[model samples]
Target: MQATQADFTVLFRLLSGVVVLPLAELARAFPDEKLDSDAEDAWQSWLERFAARVSAEAREPELRVAEMKAANPKYIPRNWILFEAYDAAERGDYAPIHGLLAMLSRPYDEQPEMEDAYFRQSPSWARSTGGLAFMS
Candidate 1:
């Protein structure tokens, strides 16, 4: 029999409870608003349902901030940044490329300028080329 979408979602939730509880705890402690969207709510609901089935697999709560940092990324270079960097490198204007590399190394920090330019959504070119793989 084919599993329904509901069934698959249930399974995904269980997996999230196993793999993402550490990430969730990190979200709570930091009060990071990134995961507070409607999409995130759906994810949390699924996780709770899944956790119900695997009661024996409980893991001790983790330090959310550290756990999140370890598991999640703060920045990813969208295609625009990559192309920009490459162009700069070709022209020997390596400042933009190096600056981006440095910023990506510490994404969670409050760098307003970095947040404005590179930390936002993937550039339009990036989305068109790969349909938003930068989100991961």
Candidate 2:
């Protein structure tokens, strides 16, 4: 099922035990007139309904850490990292490519140093910048 901001808010509240009112309600409770809007209210209602539907599903299966880690890798190469590696290879520097290969070799193992460099979403600058960023 498609996820939405309201669904995330509800799930967060359920897991964290924090009350997160809808933005529209928050806008009403707080004196921020700018934050309150008809559009936001409509969106909030839609999200609440979606969240309700999702919450009605049976509880998810709980897996042990080892089993979970085996099913889900600790690292998956991000597009921007691949782009950087490819770009460096084009410029006669193959270190990035080799490093990426090493990381991929043991995908389930936690590589702390590489986490900050390789496992992440594309940076804002790389988005729609064209070339390898868009290609890969």
Candidate 3:
């Protein structure tokens, strides 16, 4: 679907599913759709208003870091990560499993070493290759 200010405004209203995105990213997400200059200006204005609202809400002293952490998980177990861990276990190499557990143990903490390999989205190959796209 085309990305519009109304759609983004609705998404922002949800709060839980809201994601802060750049105008360029929004354009890229809906490459085929053309937005007029007025629409683009409206989107920027909406984003600014949304940001101000979020900032104002954040000023409340009752908001706690622990509460936010509890509400949101730092890591989500992806199918590709699990598949790799299982594959390694079958080959008598348990490091992958151990690494996964270690990373999950402190999900909120940044693991710079594992960020690229384990924390991000599944690689394109995982989606394109045979037997990797879906669970067996």
Candidate 4:
């Protein structure tokens, strides 16, 4: 639920500058778990109210996203990443490790190129993957 909230919060702030993104759109956050209908409705109703209140007094969209990203990092070395890095290392490929290092070097910065590659939640398969360590 924490991950879902974080995803919703970021998206809320992202679209908050212009308009409130509907709760239906936040389904992307539920990668691992999907809320039941009652829970989903409750969250949606609550978030809609909250987003409405916030949007009424929001700053410019770009400025809002910039401030949020500046304060919160977009990248972190998650367990899945550690798994991938180590797996590559065991195969004598050190590039994943180097790439992980480079990505972590600017955790808070908006590395657009790394967005699809690194800036995302863990996939379902990650549940079975063991990692060496975690870093942020």
> Which tens-of-lDDT digit does each residue in 45-105 have in candidate 4?
8778866776676567567656666766667777777788999999999999998899899
Q: For each candidate, what is the lDDT?
A: 0.50, 0.52, 0.56, 0.63
After superposing candidate 2 on the true structure, give the runs of residues whose Cα lies further than 4 Å from its correct spot: 1-63, 130-136
What is the per-residue lDDT of model 2 for residues 1-136, given as tens digits with 9 covering 90 to 100? 1222122222222222212345443322121223335556665776577557546646542333345456556556656678788999999999999999999999877787876554443455565677636522
Model number with the top lDDT: 4
TM-score of every model versus the real structure: 0.45, 0.49, 0.54, 0.68
Cα displacement (angstroms), candidate 4, residue 19, comes to 4.3
Worst 10 residues of 4 by lDDT: 127-136
Q: Ranking under TM-score, best-scoring first?
A: 4, 3, 2, 1
Q: Where does candidate 4 stray beyond 4 Å?
A: 2-19, 32-35, 56-63, 128-136
Per-residue lDDT of candidate 3, residues 48-128 (tens digit): 786566566744423533454456554556677788899999999999999999988987665679755754434656766
* Model 2 Cα shift for residue 134 (angstroms): 7.1
Q: Report how far off residue 126 is in candidate 1 (Å).
A: 1.8
Could you tell me the lDDT of residue 102 within candidate 3?
Answer: 90
lDDT of 1 by residue, 2-26 (tens): 2111222122222333434633442
Ranking by lDDT: 4, 3, 2, 1
Candidate 3 deviant stretches above 4 angstroms:
1-49, 58-66, 129-136
